[model samples]
Target: MADEKPDFEVPVGLFEDFEDLKAQVARLTAQLQTLTEGAGEEADEASADDVTAGAEEADRGDAPEDEWQYPPFILLLDPPQYDDELRALTEWVEGVLVPGYLAEPSSDARWCHLWFEHPVAVARLHALWLAWQELTDPASCGYTGPSVWHRDHLDPSMRELRGSSGPFAGCTKGEHQIDHRIPGLVPSAWRQNDA
Candidate 1:
């Protein structure tokens, strides 16, 4: 019988109601999409022929000389000249590692694609460094020596290689996997020689 009789009334306005705000946002988004779609309607209809012609031009590899000049990311092909460690590493990659790796027929495609993906060719260079480090580092060199592969070496390579001017060029029907790097390589190659 201790104070079990009466309790205070619960507050009515505890939670913030955002239904009006949410409705406004939904209406605005719909309006924006409609506006943008309307704006592009004419361009979309008129560009069909132009788009096809442009694609044909691109197919001929006559897009434009300037087009070959890649974005800032592509300039990383060569490592920065300032950092000694990176510079040495890059040089080693270009001069030593890639050449050795490419000598193997099986890995040629894998490494090539890896080189293409490097905004600055860092992947291939790093792969080489990792290979070298494998020779030096005692712990996990052979086990996980940088597993970078060239971009053009994988199934994408197969697509491009087949796509440009071959029987499979337009045949987009097939099971293809993007082989980013050498898959299923044994860890022993990455280990230090002595280790």
Candidate 2:
């Protein structure tokens, strides 16, 4: 009533002795491990029990025939930064591994496609593709978009070049500053220069 907190009796520390505390903890830990091991063993036993049923089902021809589906396009592009590399990797898979997998029809071969999730692996393949492309064409400069090599990202460069500077810069306002292209690369702003 007077705006003061009420007092209550405090409880004593639960474990009075270190050895007892350690023994209790050890017991709890052992109990937990035993429970977990039991659960795991039961699960394993259940799985083992399922084997006969699985074999019977397989015998009945309920198992699917071997057929490979093309990997999902979006999953292939999971690492957008490695798009160039992924393209080459997928090409190699389609060319070399896929044919072998199809010919062999083995479960292990199916996993080769799954192993391609690593971006670095895809990038390595992409590097190979670039090397091949350069060797074959001798002048294929690839998508040299502003994003790939410009000062700011691509959208800004496109916006600036299109005569709309920033959100505030108006057509009649600031004197248009002709933004340079990526360093060391010449940009053809004028139509005739593009040729």
- Best model number under lDDT: 1
Q: Evaluate all candidate structures by whole-model CA lDDT and list the values in order.
A: 0.43, 0.42
The residue-by-residue lDDT of candidate 2 on 68-187, one tens digit each, is 233333333446634654665677667853564234322222122333443333433344434434333312222322223233332233233222232212222223222323257565
Best by TM-score: 1
Residue 84, model 1, lDDT: 50
Model 1 residue 29 distance off true place after TM-score fit, in angstroms: 60
Model 2 lDDT-worst window of ten: 165-174
The segments of candidate 2 whose C-alpha lies over 4 angstroms from its true place after superposition are: 1-79, 83-89, 95-111, 138-195
Model 1 weakest 10-residue run by lDDT: 140-149
Error of model 1, residue 111, in angstroms: 7.9
By TM-score, how accurate is candidate 1? Answer: 0.22
